[model samples]
Target chain A: MIIKRTKSHIAEIFCNVLCVFVITVVSVNAQKLNDDFFSPKSRLSFGNYLFLEKDYLRASNEYKEFLKTDNNDTVRFKLSESFLRIGRYEEAANNFKSLFFSTSLTDEARLGLFKSLFFEKNFVRFRQYRLEENYTTEKFSHDIDRLNYISYFFDSEPLPDSSRLFSAFADLNRADIKKFYYMKKNPDTKNPVTAALLSAAIPGLGKIYTGEIGDGITSLITTGLLVFLSANNFRHDHNFRGWLFAGFAALAYGGNIYGSAASAQIYNAGVKFNFDNEVKLFFEKHNYFLPEFDFVNR
Target chain B: MKKLFYKYFLLIEIFVVSSLFPQDRLSIQFDYANKLFQTSQYFDAITEYKRLLFFDEAKKYSYKAYFQIGKCYKAGAKFDEAIKYFSTASINAANENEKLSVYFEIVRTNISRRTTSRALQILDEIEKENTNTFIRDSINYWRGWTYIFADDWKNAADAFSKIKSDHELKKLCEQVEKEKVSVTFTKAISYFLPGAGEVYSGNILSGSITFGWNLLFGYLTINSFAEERIFDGMVIGSLGWLRFYRGNIQSAEESAKQKNIAIANKILKYLQYEYKGAKP
Candidate 1:
C-alpha cells in the first residue's frame, strides 16, 4: 500500500510539469499573436496623435515601438523625422542612418544625418561624416557649399571671403553683427593674455581692446588719482597716510588688470552665443535645408 | 466561541481605524503652527509651538519649535521671553551640535536685547563646553561689541585687543577706542574753557558757538576800557564778562557731553542684546 501511494505522488508530479510547460508555450505564442494583431501602422498612427498633442517623450516611445517590427523604408524615414521633430537628435541620427545604403533615398538620408549632427553641435563627427559621403542631390550640394564657409568659422581654417561674410552679417539682426565681428576677428587678433598684460602696463588699454572705452578710461583715471594722492602724501611726510594711498593704488592697478581679462572672456562668450544663435536661426528659417518624407502611404 | 471571535474582529477594526486616522489632532496643530510662522505672525506662532509641545506625541521637532519661538520673541524685541525660550532649547536639545547652536542663539539674542551680562554668562558656558575653536573666536568677537554696548570702554578695548593683532574686529575696536572720550571729563574741561568740551567730543558746531560767546564777552570788556568810563565799565564788564563767559563754558560742556552720550546710546540701541538678524 505504501509503494502504491509513492507511485501516485510521482505520477501527479509529472502531470503538473507537463501542464506548466504547455501553459508557458501557449502564453508565448499568444503574446506574439497579440503583437501582430495590434499592427505597426496602428502604433505609428497613435504615435503621430501623441506627437500632435505635444507629448514628445511619449510619442518617441511609441514610434520606437512601431519601428521594431516595421522595416519599411518610408516608415523608417518617418521615425527618424519624428525623433528630430521632438529634439531627440541622437536617436534620429541612428534611424536616418538605416537609409544611408538605400540607393533611392541615400542622398536624403545622408543630408538628414548631417543636420542631426549639426543641431547637436557635434562638429568633429559631422565634418568627418560629410567627408566620407558623396552626395548627388542639388539640395545637399548647396548645403555642402554653405557648410564649407561655416566650418571656417569653427575650425582654424583660413577666414572665408570677407565680403561674403560682411554681406551675411548685414542681413543678420543688428545684435548679431557684433557676434559676427567677434567670430571674424577672434582667430586673427592678439592673444587675450597679451592684451591683458598690455592693459596692466597701462590701466585702460585692455578695456579698449575689449570695446569698453568708458571702463578703460575710468580705470586709468582712478589708478592715476590714487597714485597722485600717494605721491603727494609721501611728499608731505605723512608716512602712514602715504603708505595707505600707495597700497590702495596697487590694489586698483591689480584689480583693473584682472577686470580687463574678465572683460575679454565675457566678450568671447558673447561672440560664441551670438554666432550660434544666428546659425541656428538661419537654418531653422530654411526648413533645415533638407528633404522631407512624403512617400509614406496609408 | 462566537463571542470571542467577534471581540477579536472588533479589536482589529479599532487597530485599522487608529492607524488610518494618524492622530489628526497633533498634525492639525503642527500645520497651524507652520501656517502662522509663514504668515509672519511670530507671536502667534510661538503660542502654537507651545501648544504643540503640550499636546503633540512626536518630540523630534520640539527642540526646533522652541528655538523658533525664541527667534520670534527676539524678532519682536521681547528679549526676556526670547532668552527664556532659547535657554529651554539649549537644555532640551537632542544633539551636542544643536545645544551649541542654541547656546549661540542665546548669546546672540542677549546681545540683541542689549543684555550684555546675560550674553556673557551664556558665552562663559559655551567656552566651558570646549566647543569648536572657530565658534569660540566668533563668540569673543561679539563679546567685545557687547562690552561696547555696556559702555565699558576699557573692557571693550581689552576684549577687542585680544583678537586685534590679526583680525578685522581689532581694527573696529581700535576705531571705537579712538572715538571714545570720558563723559565727565568732557563736561569738566568745557567749564574751564568755552567750547573745550565740544571740541573734545568732536562737535564742531557747539564748539564754535561757545567760542563766539566767549569772544563777544571779551570784546565788550575791551570796549568798556576804550570808552574811558573806568568805574562803570569795570562793574559792567565784570558782571557781563564773568556771567556770560561762565555760561558759554557751561553750555559748551553740556552739549559736548550730551553728544557723546547720544552716540553711545545709538550704538547700544542698534546692537541691542535682542536683535534677530546675523550679528556684525
Candidate 2:
C-alpha cells in the first residue's frame, strides 16, 4: 500500500507542473489564459497605468519584473524616469546609461543622466559627463547647456558668460535668468572684517552696515549713555561710581564689537539663502528648461 | 492493469487543470499577495496587490486588493497613503458593510495620524449611516479612541461609557483626566507669587531658587533707590530684578507644561504597548 501511494504522489506532482505551464503558455488555443495577471505583458500594461498615475515606486518594480523577460527602449526609459521621479538618482543614471550608445533614445537618455546628476548635486561629475565628446546628444545639447548654466547660478564657481546664458533661454525667461546671473556675479554681501573694524571705532556702525539698524541704534545709545554717566560721576568727584560706570561702558563697547562681527556673518547667510531660494524657485517652476516627455500619455 | 493506469492518470490531470483555471489562478495570486502582507513585506505586498487589481478586469478583487493595500500602508505607519488607499477601497465596496469597514479603517488611520477632528467627523458620519448594535458599538469605540489620541481624556471616558459604563479604557481615561495638572491654575498662581506655579507643578528646587533670586534682586533695587542712587537703582532694577521676575514667570509656565506632557505621555505609552484593546 505504501509503495502504491508513493507512485501516485510522484505522478500528481508532475501533473501539477505540466498543467500550470500549459495554462501559462498563451498559444492561439489557450486564448482564455491570455489575460493572466502575472504575465509580462499584463505587468507592463499595469506598470504603464501606475507610471501614468505617478505611482513611480510601484511602477518601477513592475517595470523591473517585466524587463526581466522583455527588452524595450520606451519601458527602460520609463523605468529610469520612475527612478528619477522617486529621487533614486543613482539607479536612474544607471538605467539611462543602458540607452546611451546605439538606441534610438540616446538623446533622451543623455538628458535624463544630466538631470539626475544635477538633482543629486553632483555638479563636478555632471559637468565632466556633459562635456564628454562621445556622451553629448545633439538634439538636447541646448537644453543640457542651459542646465549647466543654471547649475552655475545654483552654486558652481566661474559662472558661464552672462550674454551666452541670456541667449540660451527664451525672451520671457531672459529677465529672470539675468537677475540670477547678476546676483551670482555681484552678491550684495557684507564683509565681517570691515564690520568688526567699523564697530570697534563707532560702537554700532558695523551693525548698521550689516542692515541691523534698529539693534545698532540701541547698542550705540546704551554704550554712549554709560560713557556719559562715567564722565558725570568723575566730574562730581565720585571716584568709585566713575570707575563702575567706566567698567560698564567698556564691557558694553566690547560686546557691541563682537556682536557687529557676528551680525555681518548672519547678513551674509541671509543673502545666500535668498539667492538660493529664488534660483531654486525659478528653475523648479520652469522645469529647468527641460523639454516635456511623457510616454504613458503618448 | 491498463484500465487502472488510465483511471488514475485522468484523476491527476483533472486535479491539476482545475486549479489552473483563470479564476483559481487569480485566487492563487491573491493568496500570494496576502501571504506577503501577513509576513510584513508591505511594499512587496502592495505591488502584488496592484498587479491583481490591474489584471482583474472583472474588478472582483478591486475592493479586497485596495483594502489590503491600505492595511499594508497602515502597518508601515504611513497614515496619509493608508487613508488615501482606504478611501479608494471604500469607493469599490460592494455593499454598506464593506463600505463601513473601509470607512472605519480610514477613521483609525486619521486617529493614528493625530488628526482627531477628521477622525471624529468620519465617525459621526458613520454613526448617522449606521444604527445596528454592533456597528454603533464599533463607531463609539473608535470615537472614544479618537478622543484618547487627542488627549481629551474626559471626552474619551464619556464616549467609552456609551459602550459600557465599566469599560477598561473608560476607567483609564478617567484616571488620566483626574491626575493631570491644571495649566490655567498654574499660570494664575505664578502671576500672583513668583515661582509658585513651578512648585504647584512639582518643581520644588527650581521654584525655591527662583524665589530666592527675585527676593534678593528686589531688595537690592529698593535699597539703591532709597539711598538716592538713582543710576544704581535703575541699572539694578532693569538688569537684575526685572530679568529674574520675568524668568520666574516663564519658568513656572514651562514647568506646568512639561508636567502635563509627562502625564499624557505615560498614558499614551500604556495605550501603545500595554493596553489590550484596539488602538489608533
Candidate 3:
C-alpha cells in the first residue's frame, strides 16, 4: 500500500511538471509569432543598429517611424544627424532647427544647424545667421568664431582682426591663420599691365617676370628668328619675302605681349587657388574646430 | 520512472523548438537581405548582408552574402573593396561553377577599373581551364572588351575575331581602325614638304600658316646665299627655315595622332552609353 501511494504521488508530480512545460513553450511561441517588430522599442533598437552600420537612409526611416509615437530628443537629434550624414542639408537644418529650444540639446542642435548651413557652401547666409542675436552659444562660441574666420578664406568677406580670430585656434595653427589673413588682405598679385609692358620692351620678358622661364625663352627665340629672317631678306633684295617675315614678326610680338598679360592673370589666380586650398585642407584636417559628438554614449 | 519520462519528453520538446527557431530567423534575415538587393538599395543591402553574415553560424549563406556585398560595392564604384569581397567569395564558393562566377566578376570589376592587364591575366587563367566552347567564347568576348578598355583596337579586333568570323564588335573595331588617321604617313609626308601633311590631315588653316612661314624664310635664306652673304644665309636657314620646317612635321604627326585618339574615343563613348550589344 505504501509503495503504490508513493508511486501515485510521484506520477502526479510528473504530470504537473509536464503540463507547466507545455504551457510555457506554447505561450513563448505565441508571443514570438505575434510580436510587432515595428513597435517604438524595436524600431529604436533597429534604427540604432542601422545607424551604427552607417546605413543612414534606412536608419532615418526607422527613426522617423519611432518618432511618430515618441518624442525623445536624442532620437530626434539622431534623425537630424542621419539627414546630415546623407547630405540632405535642408531637411537636416529644419529638423535640427526644431531642437534649438531644447534645454539639454540646444547647443548641439545649434551647432548642427550651423554645420548644415556651412556644408551647403552658402557662406553669406552662414555669416548672416551668425550675426543674429540668439544664434550664438557661450559654450561653442570659440568653435563658432573659428568657423567664422575660416569662412573669410573662402569668400570676399573682410576677415576679423588677428586677436579675435587667432584666439580660437591652437598655437601651431595661429601662424597659419595669420599667414592666411595677410594673404587675404594684400594678395600676391601680378600686374597685368606691367607684364604686357615688359614683354613689349623685350620679347618674353613679361613671361619671365611671371615665372614662366620656358615660355619666355621660347618666345624670345621665335621672335628673334623671325626678325633676323626679315632683316636678312631685306638686305638681300627679297622685298616680298622681307615684307612677309616682317608681318610674321609683328604677329609674334603682339601675341607675346597678350600672352604675357594673360600669364600674369593666371599667376594671380594660381596664388589665390593655392591659398584657398591650403586653408581648406588645414580646416578639413582639423575637422573645422568642431568637437566630436558621441551621440550613443549617454 | 514517471518523473524521468516526463523530464525526457520536455527536454526533447525544448530541444526541437530551440533548433527550429534559429533556422526560421536565418531564413527571414536572408529574405530581408534579398529584398534590399532587389530594390537597388545597395548601401542598405550591404548592411543587411553583413548582419546575416554575423549571425550565420552554419556558414550556409557566407558565399552568397560575400558575393552580394561585392556586387553592392561594385554598384557604388568602389572597385577595390568589390575585388576584395569577390576574392573572399571565390575562396568560399561551394562548387567550381560558383568559383568561376566569382572569377568572372573579378574580371569584370578589373575591366571597369581600367586594369586591363589583370583582367587579361584572369581571362588567360579561365582559358587554361579548358572550359566548353560557349564559355570559351564568353572569355574571348570579355578579352576583347579588356583590349578595348586598354585602347588597343587591333588587339580588340583580333580577340573578337576569334569569337566568330564577323562579330559586331570586331566590325566596329575595324571601322574605328579605318577611320583613324595614320600618324606615320603624316610624319613622312611632312618630312618631304613642310605643310603638305597638315593639309592632307585636314588642318587647312594651320597648313596655310606653316606654308607661308616656310616660304618667307626659305626665300630669305636663298636670297642671302645668292648675294654671297654666307653668315646671313646660315643664320636664316638654320634658325628660321629649319626650325619651322621641323616643327611643321612634328605638329602634323602630333595632330594625326590626336585625330586618331579622338576617333577612337568617339566610338568608345558611343559603346559606353548607346551600344545595344554585349559589354564588359
Best by lDDT: 2
Q: What CAPRI grade goes to candidate 1?
A: incorrect
- Judged by DockQ, which candidate is best? 2
Candidate order by decreasing lDDT: 2, 3, 1
- Candidate 1 residues B1-280, lDDT tens each? 3544564555455444544443554566678888998888986676567656644456756787888888888878898988888888878789888988888887777777778897888777778877676776666777776776676655766665665455454554455556667667876787677778778877778688777777777787787788876776687667877776677666655665576677666555654465453472
lDDT of 3 by residue, B217-261 (tens): 999999999999999999999999999999999889877877888
Q: Please provide, for model 2 over B1-280, each residue's C-alpha lDDT reduced to its tens digit, 9 standing for 90 to 100.
A: 4655775566566555754577776788899999999999999999889878877878989999999999999999998999889989999999998999899899999998899999999898988877899999899899999998888999999999999999998998899898888888887887778889999999999999998998999999999999999999999999999999989888988898899788888988988999887777
What's the candidate order when arranged by decreasing DockQ? 2, 3, 1
Candidate 2: residue A176 Cα off by (Å):
3.4
- Residue range A133-157, candidate 1, lDDT tens digits: 4433455755644554455555455
DockQ of each: 0.02, 0.29, 0.13
User: Candidate 3: where is the Cα deviation over 4 Å?
Assistant: A1-62, A197-205, A214-257, A296-298, B1-19, B35-59, B72-81, B91-98, B112-114, B123-280
State candidate 3's TM-score: 0.68
Among residues 3 or more apart in sequence or in different chains, the pairs in candidate 2 whose N, CA or C atoms overlap within 3 Å are: none
Scored by TM-score, the top model is 2
Give the per-residue lDDT of model 3 (tens digit) for A104-155: 7888888888888888777877888888867777778677777877877888
Whole-model Cα lDDT of every candidate shown, in order: 0.69, 0.88, 0.87
DockQ score of the complex predicted as candidate 3: 0.13
Chain B, model 2, TM-score against the native?
Answer: 0.91
Docking category of candidate 2? acceptable
lDDT computed for candidate 2: 0.88
